[model samples]
Target chain A: MLVELEDVSKRYQLGNLWVDALRGINLTIERGEFLAVKGPSGSGKSTLLNILSALDHCDSGSVEIEGINLSALNEHQCSLFRRRHIGIVFQSFNLIPVLTALENVIYPLTLSGTVNAKARAEKALEAVGLEQLMSQRPTQLSGGQMQRVAIARAIVSQPNLILADEPTANLDSVTSESIMSLMKQLNREQGVTFVIATHDNYVTGLASRVITVRDGELVEDEPSPPFTLQEAIA
Target chain B: MGLGWKVALLNIMRNGRRSLITLAAIVFGCTSLIVFGGFVQSMYDGMRESMIRSQLGHIQIYANGYNQYGKAEPEKYLIPDRDLSTISQLIESESNALVVAPRLNFNGLLSDGKQSIAITGIGIDAEKEVMLSSAIRIVDGEDLFPEDIEAAHLGEGLFNALDVQVGDYLTLLASTQDGAINAVDVQVMGVISTGVKALDDRLLRVNLPLAQELLYTSDITRMVVLLDETQLTDTAISTLVSAFEQHHLDLELKSWEELAGYYHQVVGLFNGVFEFITVIVLIIVALSISNTMLMAVMERTRELGTIRAMGGTPRQVVSLILLESVFLGLIGSLLGLLMGALAAKGITYAEWMMPRPPGSTQDYPIRVFVVPDILFRTFLLGFAISLVSSLYPAVKASRLPVVKALRFT
Candidate 1:
């Protein structure tokens, strides 16, 4: 198993009441799995993604990624662990406004102290079909182009797992289909695990497994029909 | 530039208005310090030179026991005429020595035949006085003749009070060395201005022979030695003192610095005020820089969160913020130095005349002098203060939690 979560419980204080963001959830994800977490707004999908990526902590449970317990690591150690092993994509496409697309892609590689980071970032951008826009800043790029740069940044370091929180929420139907296909292609070819928390049906249809969440609880974890570029192009 | 510095430079340009405001504060602070320091240093130079040329030469050689008992009994402290030649010869042997003149000080009553007033008289070698007393201004008539014992120079204020003119014969009376009352009549050849009011009111100058004739004495008070450069003062003093000791002569020496107590007091006073102003300027700069960094940290919350999630260490985050502030300081200080140097040149080229200081009677042209040491110090001060100002903000930025920062609206 690449990721194993056992009896994770999390609660948040909202105004004066305790809102359970995650309650006694248990799940496991194997290597090379393309999983989509489907949920409504405020259904703990983001919270679960945060915990899985080591961006946040669980109140009570064991989160083991690649046989390493995350709770035992401090914040600094978690940061190092994430830099070396985990990649994340945000719905807002958080590319540093001051940096060019190529620089943004190289940012992860730089953090991991990768040698020849420029060549690696260039390859990643070319793989995302952004070779023409590599020198452009975020403000100069379209929403779809920005999301492509974000994805390039995520996979440039070749992390074992990529957690995307609504990676295509801001793109149109066409761009969303293209982003979903690109992510699924990376997963299939590179054997990189993906756990994406999203609400779109197009994203859900592309996943190999779909996990449904409601009221901060996991309702279903089931296998889905594999998606293909032939169907997306049609 | 590295990635961190590249982003820092971009961030500075992105917030153009805010960065410019901070830059202006730093620039203004730096420029003020350099210009003010330059002006004060020029004043010190001017005052020191004035004091040296007016009454105190680079070094004064007096007989032993003169400082302790010269005022109580002036005759007992006078150097014999033979010893005067020995001191002059020793002074000429030093390469730095320019000229040496002997002075005799006496007090008496002066009469225009209608009114009499008490006066302090100075007897000097009239030809040597012309070479040494650059600070003395001959406002009216001409300087005294080289060996004309009949000629005299009276201070402007004293001349005005006596109602005397050049060529007028004035009777000066004093007690002779034998305790007998003696008097002589002299021609007032010129009127002089010393700029100092207290000295101008009672001073009179006459040839040395006339003073000896009236007092019936061949003794001199002290020998004044001028040097080629004021910086050679300590060397000249040490050489002269050692020479006197080797020769077994009973003589003592005083440098211009020791004789001019008022100059030291003025320097001390200005130093205190300058230090206080420096503290105020630094505080203003620190607050401005600190506020700029804090606002930057606030606006970039989501950006910072994204970087942290990408595995930026806390140390890296802190370094990025500090780098931005240091860049501001370095650029701002350099600009300030340029501006200050240009302004100093303009002011100096204009030769602007400043009003006389307190107790002074003449106006002098202003000059701004910039020293290299002061320039380096000001740059370091500004840069160091800027780094200190950013310390707290950088630490706060690095300590922010990743999840909340990422979710910050």
Candidate 2:
């Protein structure tokens, strides 16, 4: 198993009211599987992704990645584990404004002390079709191009798993299609596992496997059928 | 530079206006410290040289019991002429010694035939006295010459009190060593001012031979030794002390510092004021830096979260903030030092005059000296304040929660 979650639960306090974000979630993911988590707003999709990325801890039960119990790791250890094994993509693209696209992509590789980080970053940007825009800062790049750079940064280190939260929410439909196509191509060719939390039906259609969450509970899990642009607009 | 320092530099550059304001505060603090410190140091230097040249030489050698019993029994504490010659020869042998002059102190009545006034008198070797009393200004006539045995130099105030002009004749009377009164007639050769009111009011200077004749003694009061440099005073004293010990002479030595009580009091006051100013500057600079760093952290909350999510440790985040502050400190202090040095040079070249100080009768010109030690210390202080001031903000930036920070607008 690439990832395992057993009886995981999470709660948050909002102005003296405790909201249960996740409840007793049991799930398993195999290596190289492109999985999509689908839910409505406040359905705990983000909280689940937060736990999977080790950005937050569960209130109960255990989380394991590659047989290493993430629940047993402290904050510092979790940070090291995230740096060494996991890559995260955000909804907003989160590129450092002061750095060029190439420097932003090289950031994770540098943090991991990888040798020849510049070459690796260039190769990653090339894989995402952004080699021509390597020297451009985020402000100069379009929303779709920025998301491509974020994806390049995520996969630069060749981690075991990549988690993206609402990765295509800011892009238009045409640009979203191109970004999704790029991610699908990387998954097929490089065999990097992907777990994405999003509300878009089009993203669900592109996933190899789809899981639906509602009111902090998993409601459905199954294989996804092939999706087309005409079907998405319809 | 590491990634942290690079990011810090870029962040500082990105917020150019804010950084400039922060740098201005640091610059002002550093400049104040350097200029004020330099001014105080110049005052100390001027005061020290004035005291040394006017009354106290580098060192004074006295016969045994002179400081304790000389006032009550002047004859008992007198250094005989034989001992004076021996001590002068020993002192003059040292390479650092410039002049060894013998002096006799006495008090008597001076009369210009019609009016008589009580006066304090100094009997000195005329040529050596010129070297030791270089700070004394002669307002009328010329200094006493060794060949003019019956000539005296009256203080400007004393000359006016006696209504005597230079070249006028006067009579000096004092009690001799055996309780008998003796008198001598001398010509006033010069009028001197020491910039002190009380001293100039009763001051009188005469040749050693005349003083000995009037007092009926061939013994001197003390031997004043001037050195080539004030820094060499301890070395000279050590050499003289060894010589005195070898010859078994009964004498005691006092350096200029011990004899100048007023100089020490002035130094203490200046030092206290300097320290107080330093503390005030430190607080102001620290507050300014702290506020700047805090604002930087606030503006970059999501960016910091991105870094943390990309596996940057809390320690790395803290290092980044502190690195920015250090760079700010280094550059600002250097600029301040440059500005302060230029200002000091300008003031010195302008030749500004200060009003008369307490116990002084004449105004003195102000000169600001740029001391390397003061510059170095002020730079270090500014840099240290910057680092310490950023610590709280750095730690606060590091402790920011990654989830909430990412979610921050």
Candidate 3:
């Protein structure tokens, strides 16, 4: 198992009432599995992904990634773990605006203690089929290409797991399908696990297992059919 | 080093406007501080050297009770005869310490035939006085010479009032201690002037033995010494003064401050003002730099958050921010120092006549000397202020949590 969450509960103080964001959640994710967390806006999907990505800590219970207790690590250790083991792709395509496409992709590699970074960065760009647009700033790239560069940065260091929050929410259907197909291909070839949270059914159809949540509670966990790039590309 | 500085450079370029504004403040502050510092130092140098050269040499030796009231009784302040030659020899042998001259000061009466006036006579070895720089050589006459020591050199004002030439001979009648009027025919060999009006009108310089006979005393009154400028460096001057106590001479060695009290007090008072100005300039620089860095951190909240998310420790984050501010301050202050030095040098050599320094003649004399020592001190002060000012902001930036900083909108 790559990750296991047992009875994890998160609560926040809201003036007069304690609002529970996560209520007694238990789940396990195996290696190389593509999982989609489907829920409404406030159903705790975002918080779960944040915990999975090590960007946050749980107040009770335990979240284990690769057998290390997430709560045991401090903020610095968590950042290190996130950098080395988990890659995050944000909804806004949070690329450093000051850098060109190639530079932005190279940034994660730099952070991960990669040697010969220039060559590795070029290779990552070529993998994204963005070799020709390496010098272009994000302002010059279309939304689809920008998203591709974001993905390139996320996987540049070959992190074992990728946590993407609505990675295709900003794209048109056709472009979103293409992005999903690319991610699916990388998953199959590199065996890198992907945990995606989205409202899009197109994504839910592709997950090997689908987990649904309602009102901050997991409503269902069921084995899903194998996902393929053929339907996504078509 | 390269990682920190490279990030620093990009941060600066990314926010060029804010950095430029901060740099402007540093530039002006640095320039003003340097120019003012150099101006004051050069002015003090000019005033001090002129005073030391004209009257009191760097050091003066007098009898044990001489400074308090010895002038009232010259005989009482007189050095014992056995020690005069020995002390003179010793002072001359030391490094950059030379030119010891003995003087006898006596008061007497002088009559230019038409009128009579009270006069003070100074007896000195004119050769020693020349090297000792006990007095300035005024425009109208040759300085006192060894041969002329046997004669009297009249004050220029007295000579003018008496309507006498250099070759004129006049009878000076002095009342002896016993109340007898003793008179001598004194030759007016030269006329001298001094910036001090009172001294110029009533003083006369004559040969040592002659002044002794007129005063009816064979005792020494005071010893004046001429010290080389090189020997008066910061550490040496203090050490030289303290070493005098070890000599056990029945005399007190007076440095420049004791010899010229008013000048010393004035310079001392202005020292506080100069220091305050230097601090104010640097504080202004520090504030500007701190403000710019804070703004930069605020603007790059997401970037810092991104860095934090990518495994940067708080210490590393602080170092990166501090490195950026220091780099900007170093460049700005260096340019300012160069421009300031050039400006100060240009102002000095222009020979702008200074106004009478409070008690001096009207000349608006602002002397600007870009002393390398002064610039070095300013550079260090500026750089330190720059670094310290950024410390708080850098730490604040570094301490921000990744999520909080990432969520910064």
Candidate 4:
């Protein structure tokens, strides 16, 4: 009951022609569930994640998060949603290049008038096993370590939901496996729900539930992948 | 505020060379202004001191009918009110007044029998003159001694030009009221030099009574009163003017500033030129800062988009950009003030020998005076220009759409 999308539609203006990105989609997600959104490049998976993250909007639908109807919210309210409730991780690891790991983790804390943000940032970095790497700038950290720092930044505010778009797309298989395990462990321990859009089978294989998207429509909402990471390890 | 300043400091360091170049322009403008301003102040001080010494004793008390055109035809221009001792006593009451030296002027000819030079004579009380004009007055001969009213002090230029030595009896030729030419021989006791070239060329000095007799007018011509120069400020001029007016006589009073109106006019012209040049340099500096801010806004488009996505209103974004520019101005001002102050310090040690004053023979001592207010004003003005220059870029940055800015790559 944490999120509900009722008949969402989205379109784009390409020069003079109108292209439909997503048409008539309805979906719902409950608390503490790991949902993997799967599709190919043009299947509107990224657009759905964007709308859910409040980074973009649905043209005609009600997208609800924590009982708040996002369709009724204005741009400023959408920004507040991004700041107060939703955390995002991107494929390119959008860590500010100038800041060290600790400062990057605390960057979101500065967005709001908060108390004791330094202590909270330290705790988040510690949870990500990056307490020793807090002083290292993004360029100095390895790919897996950089992704860990981005996840730490995402979790620093203790938001109710995490939306990640192609979070493992830039990593190798081994590093990708480790990032997945870290994110899963944080989600389980903290009770924060997650929605991930990905083209990688390995990432979907690790999800508890899988929704297959094709041409902007949900084709299958299955309980689990046929081959999970747990079965692969066994 | 403190955390915001830290961000500003880091960005300034990150863009090191451009900020330094901007700061250098400010420093250049401010240093030239302070140094040139110092020169003007030095000239004004030198000119004022020389005029007080050689002529225009702080105030001149003239008799009735004497002030009209040139004291023209000295025969008719005379002070009929002849209470010199009592009036001198009356002026000595004001705490700011000093040296009540009375004077009489005459037109005559100086001759050593073989050579003759037409000259103007100024008679002074050798006992009361403060020897302020020593640069022009004779140093090689006896002073304008109190007892020697019959003796004349020849100007150095005339003494050199006429080939006359001290102790030579000079014949002064004049015309009487009956239209007959009369001649008298006067002994030369001193060689006088007024630092000014024009005054030194034809001036002769004598005792007051001697000048009165030579001019054939027995009335006291005028009383020249000297004031304590340090106390003779702008406000004191009007105070003394009204006080002298209370004396109930046909007297004329003027301050030293009034005596040098032409010099002030020249200073005004220089000030006008300096201001025009300073404004041009400032405009160049301001433009350079604006260009930097524009580049900064362009570079940080993605960052601004991120901040905007995180609940930063357009007002907040504009404020951030403007704040950065204000911070830039503040930094430039700090650097400029330090460099300008150091330049001002260096200027103070330089000594210059300028041309002799206009009416005196003395070559003045010229030194730079670093006015504190001018430095402060330069810093403030530079800071303000920097802030004004950033307004356009700040607006452009704020008006950028959040989504469009994010896609700016």
Candidate 5:
């Protein structure tokens, strides 16, 4: 198992009331599995991703990735762990506005103290079919192009897992299809594990396995029905 | 530069207007410090030179007990003519010694037959007094030459009080060393001013021989020694002290600084004002920089969260923010130094005149000296305050919770 969550729970304070964002969730993800998490709004989908990526802590129980207990690690240790092992893609495509696309892709590699960061970043951009747009800043790129840059940044370090939260929510259907195609290609060809929390049914169709979350609980976990790119696009 | 520094530089450039506003505050503060410090230093230099040239040469040598009891009984503490030659020779042995002039101080009455006024008289060595009294202004007529034994230079106030013109004769009367009254007639050669009102009102200057003849004494009060440079004053004093010990002479030496209490007072006041201004400028610059950094942090909340999620430690986040401030300080301080140096030159070139200071009789032209020490200190102050001001904001940005920061609009 690459990730194991055993009875994990998380709570949040909403003014005068305490609301449960995640409740007694138990799940396991294996290596090289492209899993999609399906849920309605405020259904603990993001909280699951947050815990898995170590961006937040679970109020109860434990989370283990690659047999290392995340609850035992401090904030700094978690950052180091994430830098070395986990890559994250945000919904808004949060590329540092000051950095060019290449620089943004090189950011995580630099953080991990990897050698030949520029070469690695270029290779990652080429993988996402954005090799020629490396020098452009985010403002100069279209939404689809920026998202591709974001995906390049995510996989530049060759992380153990990539967690994308609503990665294609802001793109149109055509652009979203292209992005989904790129991510599925990376997963199939490179055997890169992915756990994406998204609302789009098209994203779920591309994943090898799909899980649904509702009211902070896991309602379904099953293999996705085999579908072709043309069939999903139609 | 590291990735952190690169990000910091780009972030500052991203907000050009805000960065410029903060830089302007630092520049203004730094320039004010340097310019004001330079002006005060120039004033001190002027005052010190005036005091040294006008009354107190670099060093004054008096007989033992003269400073303590000479005022009450001037004759008892007089330096005899015999000892004067020995002291002068010993002082002149030092190559740095420029001139050693002897002065005899006596108080008496001056009369123009119709009017009489009490006066303080100085008997100066005619040739050496010319070099020692370089700061003394001869307002009317000419100075007394070496051969003018019967000539006197009256203070402008005293000259007017007696209603005497150049070449007019005045009767000077005083008690002799033996407690007997003596009188003499002298021709007024010049009217002088020392830029001091009270001193000028009762001042009288005459050649040494005439003063001795009038007082019926061949004794002098003290010797004033001028040096080639004021910096050599202490070295000269050390040499003179050794000579005095070797010759077994009973004498006391006072530097010009010890005699010019007013100069010390003025310097103390100026230093206090400078410190006060420094505090105010520091506060203003610190606030300006702090506000700028805080705003930058707030606007980039989501970006910072993204960085943290990408494995940037809190320390890296802080380093990025502080690096931005350091760049601001470094660039701002250098620019401020350049501007301040130019302003100092411009002000000096302008030759602006300041009104007469309190208790002074004449106005003086202002000169702003660009002291290297003041420039360096102001630069460091600006830089240091900039770094300190950003510390709080940097920490605040670093400690932000990642999930909430990511959600920040």
Candidate 6:
């Protein structure tokens, strides 16, 4: 198992009332799996992704990645582990605006103290079909190109797992299909596991397995048909 | 360049106007410090050299008790005539002594035989003094001849007060060594100004022979020794002291700094004022830099969060911010030093004359001296203030929580 969440629970204080963001969730994901977490708005999917990525704490649960307990690591160690093991993509395409695409792709590698990061980042961008746009800043690139750069940054470090929250929420349908196909291709070719949280069917339809969350609890877990960009759009 | 410095450079360029404004404040602060320091240094140098030339020589040698009791009873503590020649020869050989002049001091009443006024007089080797004291200005008549015993120079104030002119005969009366009244009849040779009100009001200068004759004494009060330069004062004093000890002469040496009490008071007061100004300017500059950096940190909250998510440590984030401030400080200080040097040169060349200070009778020209040490101190101080100002904002940025920061709009 690459990830394990055993009876995780999380709460937030909203004004005077306590709101349960995650309630008694138990889940497991193995290595090289393409998993999608699907739910409506306010369904605790983002919270689950946050906890799995070690970006936030679970109030009462065991969240482990590759046999290492997420709760046991200090803040600094957590950042190191994230850089070494986990990569993340966001809906808004969180690329450092000041850096060009190639620099942004190599940012994670740089933080991980990798030498020859530029060549590796260039290869990653090439994999995303963005070899020509590597020198362009985020502002200069289009929405699809920016997302591609974000994906390149995530995989540039060759992490074991990638957690993307609403990765295609900001893109149109055609661009969204292309982003999912790229992730699917990387999962198959590079053997990198993925856990994506989204409401878009184009993302969940492509997943090999889907976990549905409603009102901070997992209500369904099931397998789906294998998805391809041509099948989803047609 | 390291990633920290690259990020810092780019961020500084991101907010072009704000960064420039902060830099301007630092440059202005440094420039003011350099210019003001140069002006004060020039004043101290000018006053020191003027005082040395006008009255106090590089060093004064006197009998042990003359400074304490010579004014009350001038004849009681005079250096003996035989010892004076030996000490003069000793000083000339042991140090770079330019002029070793003997002086006698006396107080008496001077009259045109019809009107008499209280007066303090010095008997000097006029020819030697003319060589040593460039500050001596004769306004009306030629200086007294070295061989003229009957000739005297009346201060401008005293000349006016006594209603006398050149070639007038004056009688000087004083108590002799044996408590008898003795007098001399002399001709006023010239009118002179020393720029000191106290010295000009009731002062006169005459030859050594007449002073001894008027007071019925052959003893001299002290010896004034001039040096090649003011920097030679301490060396000359040390050499003279050692020689006096070797020869078993009863003498002590006083440098011009010790004799000029007013000069020290002025320096102390100006230093205090300059220090206060420096502190105030530092506070203003520090606050300006802090405000600009804080705005920068606040605006970049989301970007900082992204960097953290990519595994930037807190220390790295803080280093990035501080490096930006160091760059600003280095550039600003260098520019300010260049501007200040040019401004000092321009002011010095303009030859602007300042109004006479209180109790002084002549206007002094304004001159700025840009000492290298003062420039270096100003640069270092500005740099330190800049770094200190960045610390709080850098720490604040480093402490931002990752989740909240990323979620920041």
**What TM-score applies to chain A of candidate 6?**
0.95
lDDT of 3 by residue, A38-86 (tens): 9999788888888887778888989998998999998778877887888
Stretches of candidate 5 off by over 4 Å are: A224-234, B111-117, B156-168
Candidate 4, residue B228: the lDDT equals 74
lDDT of 1 by residue, B1-409 (tens): 6788899999999999999999998888888888888888898998898888878888988889998899888888888998888888989996478889899988999999999888889888888887678888998989888667788898888899997889999999988777788999989999888777677778889999899888899988888888899999999888888898999989888999999998899999998988999999999999999999999999999999999999998888898899999899999999888877777778878999999888776798888888677789889998998899999999999999888899888
Runs of candidate 4 with Cα error greater than 4 angstroms are A1-81, A193-197, A207-234, B60-81, B105-123, B126-207, B218-225, B238-252, B315-328, B352-366, B407-409
Per-prediction TM-score: 0.93, 0.93, 0.82, 0.77, 0.94, 0.92
Model 2, B1-409: lDDT tens digits are 5555677889999999999999999999988888888889998998898778878899999888898888999888888888877788889885378888989999999999898999999999999989998888898999889999999998878898987888989999999999898999989999998877778889999999999999999999999988999999988888889999988899988899999898899999999999999999899999999999999999999998888888877887798899999999998899889988888888878889999888776788778889999999989998999999999999998899889889989
> Candidate 2: deviation at residue A220, Å?
2.8
Regions of candidate 3 where Cα sits further than 4 Å from its true position: A13-19, A112-114, A226-234, B63-72, B79-101, B106-213, B227-267, B361-364
Residue pairs with colliding backbones in model 4 are B136-B193, B194-B361, B195-B360, B195-B361, B195-B362, B196-B360, B196-B361
Please give the RMSD to the true structure for each candidate, in Å.
2.8, 3.2, 4.9, 5.4, 2.7, 3.0
Q: Candidate 5 DockQ category? A: medium
Cα interface RMSD of each candidate: 0.8, 1.0, 2.1, 2.5, 0.8, 1.3
TM-score of chain A of each: 0.95, 0.94, 0.93, 0.94, 0.95, 0.95
Return the top candidate by TM-score: 5
* Clash number for each model: 0, 0, 11, 7, 0, 0
TM-score of 2: 0.93
User: In model 4, what lDDT does residue A53 have?
Assistant: 76
List the TM-score for candidate 5's chain B.
0.95
Off by over 4 Å in 6: A223-234, B111-117, B154-162, B165-169, B185-191
Comparing 1 and 3 on DockQ, the stronger one: 1
lDDT of 6: 0.88
* DockQ for each numbered candidate: 0.76, 0.63, 0.41, 0.28, 0.80, 0.57
Q: Rank the candidates by lDDT, best first.
A: 5, 2, 1, 6, 3, 4
Candidates 3 and 4, the one with greater DockQ = 3
Winner on TM-score between 3 and 4 is 3
Q: What is the C-alpha lDDT of each candidate?
A: 0.89, 0.89, 0.77, 0.74, 0.91, 0.88
Residue B409 lDDT (model 2): 92
- For DockQ, the strongest prediction is 5
Of 2 and 3, the candidate ranking higher by lDDT = 2
Question: Between candidates 3 and 4, which one is better according to lDDT?
Answer: 3
